[model samples]
Target: MASYSIGDVADKCGINPVTLRAWQRRYGLLKPLRSEGGHRQFDEADIQRIEEIQRWIKSGISVSKVKAILDTNQGAVDKGWITQQEELITILRCVRPDDLRFKIVEYSQQFDAATLIDHVYIPVRQRLGFEQNTVRNICGLLDGALIEYVANQLILSRKRKGKPALLISWDDPDRTRLWLEAWRLSTQGWHIDLLAEPVELPRPEFFPGHHIFVWAGKLITSRQKEQLEYWHEQGYSIFHHNPDLTS
Candidate 1:
């Protein structure tokens, strides 16, 4: 039997450590044993439970729904006859191995390259597991066509905007991704400039009144974390998506 610490499980599961801790504290999905020094140590079963929770969330189930199902040990919840567990399974089973790639190719045919990249390919990647290295690799292999198309769409979409929002992303992010994410924000009328890292962000200026910043990276360090706290204090709506699922 293997017992892993919180960091170990987070790395293996492709989830953020903060998110893992929140799941335990907030959702009761994991109950790890604490070491003498108070560090949490979890077993394989705990890891699996986190994965299941991730899967449920991906299917649009709220954390409350997941907690209720876990608490009751029910096969599935009523949810008006459409169970979260069932819906997640269906989506997982239906996603063919190369569905994303195929969809990208198909989208290229119907829409101009940029439109395909923004509306089609980007959304497909968003649905994928962020921590899965394969998600980036596969998307990378298809990058040339997708990037070109998406960049064009973003340029075109910029004409009709409010000011932009600032963005900071992980270095070497799935290249096609961070840009598209910025584009998504921009389309919602936000002007954006992706920073080197959240910590590198300059103090907010008011030329175009850029007031928000988003961090879309693999990890956040302590210093960047302080910056995030500061941003929150300044009344920004910051969001981090957890991409891990347990079953």
Candidate 2:
């Protein structure tokens, strides 16, 4: 049910914009819907095709061979592509963590916290790949239930001098992971702040001292490692988890 621009599709699929257009023009890999202004508009179908192409590329399959495969299996490819896209979008929209948690608590006789996480939270995150859309959904759910849970807890902690909640995020090529974490932490009662872009180890003064800084995927740059160390030194607790490591 979601329609995305070519840029949105490229960001989701982790492909360069120019390369995406090139594939369209030369390889006929994707035929996107055109806007009134002649802009390339893509939907779930185009996103799937790009993902398949990315898989082939990662596996060392030649672009030409990949194209031939798509050509020969056009019907099947289209069906599978659109199906996967629709499922992802659906899972992304539903299976929210906050709602699942409340349902668990409200129906404790029927469901438990662990059951909720396993059945609802975990699967949606896994499919959505932790992006901004997923994050927004998770946050909206948390804003109602989890935030209240944390506020109640905070009232009990009124006497303790707690550190300010810190939010640290690195600019990722694909922001799904970042978005998921932001919403997940917010659900846990942490204040949510974002760095719109990646930063150095010693972040700017605007970043709170007591916040939880999250890092994602492969730490491919020295700056990333430095940022991690800097936050650790600043007394902010780090919660680091790699999906690939667990999965």
Candidate 3:
């Protein structure tokens, strides 16, 4: 019988409040009760329904098609991420910077960062990796577009009111993945400050009271582990990202 605000639901479901509002206003996906103040109030059922929608999205079902599937209570139809990935690949191969940026922004609006990264961006990168000779050139183009998109998103996220957090990458070769990870966190309502460069373990005191998210694509060395443990003991919240977690 408990009621929750939109922000609470967004935090619990790992969705942006803007996306939740869009779901109601545009897609008619959610119908929450209105309080005396005319504010949206959600119950436990709404949270469960949001999770169901997330599962469908993670399974590669487009948002526009989700309502029909949910109403029918049918299992997910395998639309897959091929179409989206193909469109992005074409834009990248053509070296169309404007189209590429537009496509990336379009996808970000439709899908959350995690869904877009896992289903579209990462797959496109992998597909390009198999190219005969122009893999580097094409992937570089894609990375540039994505970096620009994420940078803008980061700036926008900073303008919003949210918990302050610092994201750092340690010895991770794939810089694009780090940015994508930060973008994913930012979409979840965190004001992210990302250290894009690979650096040694930083002193927690430098950013007191800020949650620290560490990304190490490789295995954690003992020294690094000790430093993280030290930070934990000093009352710092640390989120360590490794291959197992990211993969």
The TM-score leader among the candidates is 3
**Candidate 3 — what's its lDDT?**
0.79
Candidate lDDT values, in order = 0.56, 0.54, 0.79
Name the weakest run of 10 consecutive residues (lDDT summed) in model 1.
Answer: 238-247
Q: Comparing candidate 1 with candidate 2, which one achieves the higher TM-score? A: 1
List the pairs of residues colliding in candidate 3.
none
Top candidate when judged by lDDT against the true structure: 3
Clashes of each: 13, 8, 0
- Clash count, candidate 1: 13
Candidate ranking (TM-score, best to worst): 3, 1, 2
Q: What tens-digit string does per-residue lDDT give for candidate 2 at 74-191? A: 6543545334334434533686554455543553345443333333443344334445564555544433453444344445444445444544455443343444444444444445
Model 3: per-residue Cα lDDT over 1-247, one tens digit each: 9999999999998999999999999999999999999999999999978887886676446788779757644331145566888898888778898999888888878877777886688757756764667754689899888988899989999888888888888766678888988888887778988887877666567777778888774356678788888878878888686432543
Q: What TM-score does prediction 1 earn?
A: 0.40
Mark the 10 consecutive residues where model 3 has the least summed lDDT. 72-81
TM-score of each: 0.40, 0.32, 0.62
Screening candidate 2 with a backbone cut-off below 3 angstroms (N, C-alpha, C), the clashing residue pairs are 130-176, 130-177, 131-176, 165-211, 166-210, 166-211, 166-212, 201-227
Residue 148 in candidate 3, Cα distance off native in Å = 0.7
